[model samples]
Target: MSIQITTLDSGLRVASEFMPNIETVALGVWFDVGTRNELPKQNGIAHLLEHMLFKGTSRRTALQISEEIENVGGHTNAYTSRDLTAYYARVMHQDTELAIDLLADLIQNSTFDATELEREKQVIIQEINLSRDTPDDIIFDYMQMAAYGNQPLGMSILGKPEVIAKISGADLKKYAGIHYCAPKTVIAVAGRVDHAQLLDWVKKYFGQLSPVSDAPIPPSVYKPENILINKDSEQAHLSLALPACGGKDPDYYAYSIYATLLGGGSSSRLFQEVREKRGLAYTVSAFLSNVDDTGLLGIYVGTAPGEVAKLAEVLREQLVDSSRNIKKAELDRAKQQLKAGMLMALEQPFSRAENTAQHLLTFGRVLSVAELIEKIDNVTPADIHRIVGKMISAKPALAGIGPKKSMKVWEKFELT
Candidate 1:
């Protein structure tokens, strides 16, 4: 099901996608996050505030927040990303009002108790430690740093230990009061939803949320670099990144097709050549990270210490070869894989709700499945060649963690 939207006088957006046969509904409130919106002292404030919301509100305690939803056989959750922080719920259709009211209450009335802040702070610090210990997880953070260099887009959302320790309850309240305004908020629902009823509930609970004056964040400036960290490991972790277009760019679809043909799945070039054929690595894949004003297209591989050089050379060879020799059959397979992935995502209520919010925030409207499929269908071999040429024409940001000898292979131009 596709979505319909209505904007409130308070500036909050309410959207719904109705699936008649389903008894459950998924709904969420999205914020137009100031991704680069915080001051230098406020690096991880956006994510810190997310954890605080569930701790307590003026109307209910933290346990009550969990008990209320679970008692009703519904689940509530939240997540923070580079550009957005969302609070979501999945519930039986009849319980939609309760879900909406609880979510609105959490956003508007969260009290940020001091004791709760101290406790949650430790939890997050532990989280930061856990991320550091996971080599695969930490490598992407390094990759982003190499991609955007000193910009907010490059900073880890989990934040630095010192910064998280410094964030206070008052800090969370101040940030929320300004950035979590009605204008920055969106309420999206999918599955067995009644638009009029949903709108009425939203207006009653969210109508009073006031708008805040916000200044535009400076666009991220990309200054790609190469970073390598020496460590003791069984395998060398490699991440190769190059600049790419944002969500709205005309070439975004073509870029997606290009990446798919390059190594998006097991049957794609990187997987087949690097793993299935020569057995150089167990995990080799290409992916895209598209955000508001800019994006990165990267390929990651984990290979043996002795084979790291071969893997790096092969990766460069595939990029250069595929840009010139991509065939129609290869393009067709990538396009079919991409289209099927999108269409299959539409059936899940959570995914539908996410797409509704994401599209509304990005394009100011939701794109239908038919529209998306048509775009994927139109990408051809020539389009892949042209786009891949653009992707591989520049010096890429290389990030790696392993023995210094093996990781250094990525810093040389011999592969080209």
Candidate 2:
């Protein structure tokens, strides 16, 4: 069935996909405000606010919120990302109204208590420290810094420890007021849902939200950078990135196909070349991150310090080779893999609901199952070749963490 959407008079979007076969529903409130929406100094406010929502609301304490949901056999959680923050719940079909009302209460009635804010501040500080202690996790942050410099686009979603410490309750409330308005919010529900009821709940709970008048954010530049971190570590962590197509760009599908063929799994070129055949690394994969107007084509590999040099060479070689040497069979397999993954994701209510909300925010509408498949099918070997060449021709950005000797070798992978 088609996903239904309604925009309340207040500008909040209500979207729903009804799957009749199941008796469970996944629903969420998705907001466009994220780390990038913050001021330079308020890096972690978006994420902190996400945590604060669960701590308390006007009518329910944090424990009551959890107890009520659990008593009904439902699970509720939230996450903050670079572009959006989502609070979602999976509940039995009969509890759809309850889910939407709960989400509404969290988003609109949260008081951002001062004491809760202090405790969450320390918790986020520890979260930051934990990421730093994990080499592979922290290397991505360093890679992002190298790729886009200090812009919000490049900054860590978790924010810096120092900045997190200084983030006060006033900061959280003020940021939320400006960004969590009707114009910036979406409520998406999938599975055993009624579009009419969802719309009604939205109007009842969110119809009063006033739209904020904030200035639009300008596009972020993708500047190339390279950083080699010397640390004592058992394994070397490496991330190499090149500029690529954005989320809404025409080449998005082609770039995705090429990335999958490169290192998506055990059957991929990078895995076969770097891990299976040579046994250089246990973990190696390619990733594509696409924001509103910018994107990155990147690879991450974790291996023993001694094997960093060899893995780097193989990665560079495979990337260069893929632009021209990609065969029809490899392209076909990648297409199938991507198509299957897409179809499987649609079968899940959470993925469907999340996609609906995110798509409405990103493209103003959700792509139908046929629409997504057709786009993925339209990608040809020539398209892959063209985008691969275009993406890799730019100077690559590199981030690595290892002993000094391994990092010295890491610096040698640059094309220039």
Candidate 3:
């Protein structure tokens, strides 16, 4: 893929790829600051700000914002994560300029009306309530808390209801002013984009953004421990996490392959051993979460309450056995899966735009498809063993939610 990157006078970076065959363009502005940039009291403000920005701007009402985009048969949305927040749109190539203008208006001109603020708080509070009631969903948050404790990294992006209610328009404005500067932002576009014209549009629209750097991000120190939550669910939900390398670590690719081979699909060790063979769990999968400084390699399992302890034992055995005897065939399969995923993403404009933006923020450059595949290809059986060895040797953070009896089993269980 051909990608071009430019830095505006204001320090905002712009990158684009021209997909001449596609009729639509996917574009977005991404900020380096997110939940990790907030203080303890400001836990959920980043997400609240995401909703409020869509509520209204100085030049348009909230209805007008959605109306204009939809009138053109386009779509827009935003999301907040641990280390990034993004506002994005997909529109016909001819409407790319309009998308850019609308996004600019959002960051620069949002009014943050008090009435809108109160209404949106209730909306987010409902969202929090919904998440709490979902066993599989809330278990990850408990896992995060178990891994990172009370630090910014461990805090939920949704924040708490009491804190959300306390946040005011002025507080949002202050946070935005401190974190939404040009030096901490990236604008990316993919599919039928014109580099020169796009660069001109970015300069004209985002030139006024302050060049100041964002507030210092808090340290995301990993502190491993076990945590349990009592609930009345029929199935026991368990999340096991071991601290691992971050996005920038040389071992990132290796760790990703390790996760994929361990429990990523039906043919994976955990799925075959825990589900197909032993009938211990209905759902078993492994995943990786990475930020700038730290990461988590996690396995999630859902099973009958009576089988939760056996599930943990199976997980430990699989991990240990895989480390000692990871096969060449499985390693090759994992690499192929990862490479196919990257290639498939290349066909979608939205993925290209989002991945370009993230790569620029994380690595200060767009990694070529070739470079990425080569990294995955270089991972050997020894590398898989190395990552697995590191993971099982470290203390794992265990988080469980289920009936009282299931919770009791987890309380007495240790992964190592």
Candidate 4:
């Protein structure tokens, strides 16, 4: 439960939490660049670079990277998101140094070989086609596109097949060189480890890398007016989004409670009203996505083609009603659920490490578990109602994939 933070002379910020009873350590390097940092022509380069980094580095082949970690019984992987790309490894406490070196080499010295780039391009294109074939996956991307419009935040992390095909080794190298600097990266480790020893290892490995000038900020804010996409599928995939609060917003915790009450679980209002009582759909839920500058409150549902209209109508009614007359008992349950979820997540070391690094990256400091718990507990029914009032006043962007008839029926549920 004790955490330590340090800043290396090289500009890499290192944070660690000591868990004396644990036998494994989770370490990660988070780069503060993703789709939002890409220019129009380089939409998917950050994600592509994630794939390429694993392909090979100047010091080792891709298989060699895999073998080295597996030989130690360690696991390694990476992911790209709208705002960051992360490379992480979990290993026995004794293997922490080896893990650190391997991650450092992959990030700082990746070769981005031309042959490998061509092969990976085809791999990603196949991935894009695969996503298109899956209705549930395809609809969320469309929802993001509709919510953010033409902004970088709206662009797909996988990029278009045509665009991904054109991404060459040169593009990968240029983007990596510009965005992957010490100032834009955070190295985080948690579990059984010595904080001083971890700092020394980071200094030895990453200290020599220089910082980049003019680090890019994330894309400008742009909330869409309204948008819809038509696709052929068995059931209709529907998503509605309105811009909400980010991490720093005063209403951020209140919005989380609001979202939970709206559609968090089986007992949630969306499920109880839309599915359990009315039999409108098989699946329905809501989520709060809080980014650096802005956030989104989204509602998603999958239903029979003929029931899409009914589902949307019920969802709107629930939204409007919740804002108008949220019961005190329901509000109390939502707060307890959110607090319990947050407390449970803190029990895992990996979650703790990630929570530490992401808050540092976004807010420049981490809020303690006590602070977060208190914030959630303090959100009264009145607070939620006020936030809901603001949410209802804003226009929501919608996306759907299903029969042509369902696509046209959304006009009836349009936000005014």
Candidate 5:
């Protein structure tokens, strides 16, 4: 029921949250460099490195890495995002050492074989193809491009097939050497654990990392524009976005509450108005995203091609209405929802570890549940109104995938 943080001499941040009742622990090595750290030619190198690391390490073969974890009744997984990359595992408390060693090996001793690197490129190309086939998924990629132009932050993490095809084993090693150093990395653990023992384990295995490594990431610039993709799909997947605050901004919590009340769940405004009352779309939701220096408040919907115009009209009205007509009841409901979700995550070791790593990287400290709840509770109706009003004032970037005829429908839709 307590959290402890320590900085090793190598500049690595080891953060752990102790839960006395749990029998399992979750731990991970999180690196702050991701897609944004890549050069334009090396678009998907971060994700490619993630796959290559698991292919094999100097101490163990690919099969050995998987077998060792599964044999102990534990599992390991990793993901690469726009801002961070994580390799984590869940295991019984007694197997914590094995998990830590396996993670350490992947980062410090990986031997990116040439044969494996070539195979992984094809695998990622297939992944890219699969994503393209998914309309709802790919629309977001298009929306990102429209939002931030051709910059690193706006690029898809999976990368383009042509770009990935040219990346070699040397590229993976070079990228890792640059970004996987002590200064930008965090070793986060949660659940039943001893903080002192955890630090000892980290020092033994991760002591080799260089304490100083420069992270030169290009700044992200938000440029709102429109994008349209014509496909023979049955429904139109549409996304709209407006600039918002970064994760450290004072208004971050207020923006979170604003998005929740807008379309976080079935009871929220977008779901009730678009799906229940008018029956215009099957899936509709709003999300808030906060990156390093910028963020977005976005709304997404999938509807029949013929209903695009009506959907746009209703969205405009709802966006405007939320600013002026938000009631105390709605604000209270959103606050409770945020608080409940935050508290529930505390019981999940994996979620707790993930949030802990992210909080440290973003805010340079872990936020207490009390502090988070107070922030959520302090968001007044006026805060919501102010956030909504500011969001609506900016021109929105619109992205869609559907029939060609619907292109004109989306082109004419405006929400500024």
Candidate 6:
């Protein structure tokens, strides 16, 4: 497989990986604008705009857009995150042109009709309600809010219900005009794609967009704070987070290994200690999310309400133990697991395409699979110890959803 990247005169970036053996193409556009880019009052505008883009464009109705793709046996979807909004389609290699044109039209020239805006407001409100109904979803939002307080990074991507209801078509268009510039967008394609043809299509579809004045980049703020939400539920949801490395941080690889050893799988410390040995919780895991300026090492577990205290105790013990001393064997295992997962994910065309685009956007270049494995393998036991020490020193922010009594119980067993 070979990857080619080009920047059009209009500033849109096109990156493609040719997979001649495959018959499908996964193509997408990524915008570096999401909830974090919104003004205080326009909190949910980014996500709302994402939804409206698919509703209709200057050339096609929502139903027409769906039907066109389905007729070609293609699939299309979109998502909004803390810092980006993405729209993607997977189709037969022969239909790449149609997919690109449809995506470009939806993102760049959406009408955002008044009626459509009102209709989408209800849809988003329902989405918010649905999120609240799911404990797993709500818990993460709460944990993020607790970690960053009221900063832009802390705000929910779904935005507040009241604010979402008031988002106007004008708001959507204005925000889109400002942040959805060619310079801040990328077109990524993989699987049975020709780089030259993809670049030609990108230029034809996206070159018309006029560049806008660059907006100031927002600083990602990470505050050490704890928040607990009292709810009537059978299982208590607990999340603990500490500020860590970003995508560009030098310790990025080390931190990934650290997270894997902490709670990545069933053999991980948190899982084995908190669940296997003590039977304190049924589900436990750890993950790392690296943004532009900052990152987070987050641990989450769902356990019986009565076992919240024991769960917290065991988690703290494991954390402190790891921070003080991580065995060389354990460190090697974590590195192997991290590298193995990276290699496995690269086999999928969609994953490869997305990985290439994200790496290019964030790091200015993509690291080859072999280079990534080498980096992971080079991490020493001392590297793991140093990362863990930094994490331990950075007081973690905790978020819990369950009975108020559990909060009181868990609070008594803070990380020492």
For residues 1-416, write the lDDT of model 6, one tens digit per residue. 87898887777788999988899999888877777776667778888888999989889999999999999999999999888788999999999999999998898788988888898899899999999888777888887887887787888899999999888888788788888888887788889998888877887887656566488667767886777878888988888888888878878888899999999988888878887888888889999976877889998899888998777778777888877688887888898898788878988888888888788778777788888888888888788778887888877888888888987775565665
- Which stretches of model 1 miss by more than 4 angstroms? 413-416
Evaluation by lDDT, superior candidate among 4 and 5: 5
Clashing pairs in model 1, backbone N/Cα/C closer than 3 A: none
lDDT value, candidate 6, whole model? 0.84
- What do the candidate models score in CA lDDT, each in turn? 0.85, 0.86, 0.90, 0.85, 0.90, 0.84
Q: Candidate 3 — which residues are off by over 4 angstroms?
A: none
Clashing residue pairs for model 4: none
State the displacement of the C-alpha of residue 376, model 3, in Å, after optimal TM-score superposition. 0.3
RMSD (CA, angstroms), candidate 2: 1.3
lDDT of 2 by residue, 1-416 (tens): 67888887778888888898999999998888687776668788888889999989999998989988888999999999888899999999998888878888888888788888889999999999999899889988888888988788888899877888888877777787888888888889999988997787777777546666464755678897888889988899999889987889878988888889998878999999998999999999998887878888889999999998788789878887777788989888998999999889888999999989988988998877788888988988878878878877888888999899998888878653
What is candidate 1's lDDT per residue for 1-416, written digit by digit as tens? Answer: 55789997777888998998899999999987844676657788888898899998989999999999998899999998888889999999989999999999899899999999999889988998999888788989889888887788888888888988999888898888888888777889999999999999998887557766475655886687888999888988889888888888877898888778788998899999999999999998888887867888888888898898788778889988987898788889999998889879987998899988888889888888888888888877788788778877777888989988887776773324
Report the error of model 3 at residue 162, Å: 0.7
**Number of backbone-clashing residue pairs for each candidate, in the order shown:** 0, 0, 0, 0, 0, 0
| Clash total of candidate 5 | 0
Off by over 4 Å in 6: none
**Model 1 residue 110 CA deviation in Å:** 0.7
Candidate 5's TM-score reads: 0.98
Superposed by TM-score, candidate 2 places the C-alpha of residue 315 at a distance from the truth, in angstroms, of: 1.4
Better model by TM-score: candidate 4 vs candidate 5: 5
| Reference-based TM-score, model 6 | 0.97
TM-score of 2: 0.97
